[model samples]
Target: MKLEKSIIGMVHVQALPGTPNNKHSIEEICEIAVQEAKTYEEAGLDAIMIENMHDVPYLKGAVGPEITASMAVVARAIREVVNLPLGIQILAGANKEALAVAKAANFQFIRAEGFVFGHVADEGYIDSCAGELLRYRKVIGAEDVKIFTDIKKKHSSHALTADVDIDETAKAAEFFLSDGLIVTGASTGKAVYLHELKSLKDKVQIPVLIGSGITAENLEEYWNYASGFIVGSHFKENGFWKNPISKDRLKVFMEKVKQLKK
Candidate 1:
């Protein structure tokens, strides 16, 4: 599979639940999302993904209609502002909802949490959705929109399926027609294991992305092994998500990635 060398930045919109400072209205959230997308684009990142990461303690299946509709509006606004390849990810394993939003916003892809394997997560059981998700995508005529599946997902327990290794699970996703494979750390904002990244890259013919915990210091280490990265935390001021995206931090990170390319 062909892939881009540059890193893929994530704009984790401040749409989480129960935060006093969080935006209460959908209009407010979408406005912030648009600004964040433009910032990521200006930073020279290859692509941008908008996720409801702030919506912590996420629900198991489908979220409320308001959440989905709100997310669509935010995603659409971001798409309107940036020409970069846009992706949408609903919290937990809301694959169908995310796909719907992606289709509505004309997004290029989505980051699916539990696409091809069953596992126990903090919220509860996250059953594999590759079968249903692909069918839904077909029904909506969004076959061109890529499905980037996560293997050995973070912040969740895959111990129920521990008997199956990462390579086997990744192969299963590929068999199910996943457009790409994402290998993440054990939790959000954590770094991935280089060993696991190498193993997955060696096994798959499709694009493989590191989904978290990338920093300027480690970009060189993983750049050669994976096709791309999805970064968020390190780009923020003092490495905090709530802090604004730092222009200097982004400049430094991009410089490192460029040097590695040479």
Candidate 2:
């Protein structure tokens, strides 16, 4: 699937079984996830992505099979409900596990971190996963599942690779075969700089997505440059990713997107 110029809604699934903040049973998690996916499709999102974001203080690199198992259930449930393209992200850089889940669930793609340069994320050190992850995808027969990687990913210190600028990072990821690139501010809910975004657009051949802080109010600033927007916080009740997806907010946001398309 060629994913370009898509308004992809972030469907952050409730904490799945085995995480510290997990409150719902596996069934409950799947139910809530399916409903969120349904709402995003009904509101006109081009695609919806499921994330284990609520699994706070995430694991450093690998996740247990239970995490993968529950995600499979949720992903399948969401697939059953929504006809739009669906994707997955296993937090804290579990790119291989996420690919396995995406394949089992028949998901279209996955959002990944630590695909190129090393970073010290809040969870701990995340090593580059590109070589292993891509090989794993081939072994699993999931070459069609695209991997959209984060460059200088949010909420982390890049001092380790400070010498390597964003442009260098973009070339490296491309050399490593990333299907797309993501640009973000320092953290979630923070806006990506248009100048920096333009710089990246000038630097890379792959699709560039704004990974955070996109709202109806600021959509125009990025629409001309970004091929996609991975929106989460802006669709919630109070612009919080933790809050449930607000249909009214989504409707209003999509209305603005429609006008921009004109």
Give lDDT tens digits, candidate 2, residues 37-142: 8888888889999999999989889899999888898998888878898899998898888999999989999989999989999998889989999999999999
Model 2 Cα shift for residue 97 (angstroms): 0.4
C-alpha lDDT of all candidate models, in order: 0.85, 0.91
Q: Indicate the residue-level lDDT of 143 in model 2.
A: 97
lDDT of 1: 0.85
Q: Evaluate residue 138 in candidate 2 and report its C-alpha lDDT on the 0 to 100 scale.
A: 96
TM-scores for all candidates: the values are 0.95, 0.98
Clashing residue pairs found in predicted model 2: none
Candidate 1: residue 91 Cα off by (Å): 0.7
Count clashing pairs, candidate 2: 0
- Candidate 2 error regions (>4 Å): none
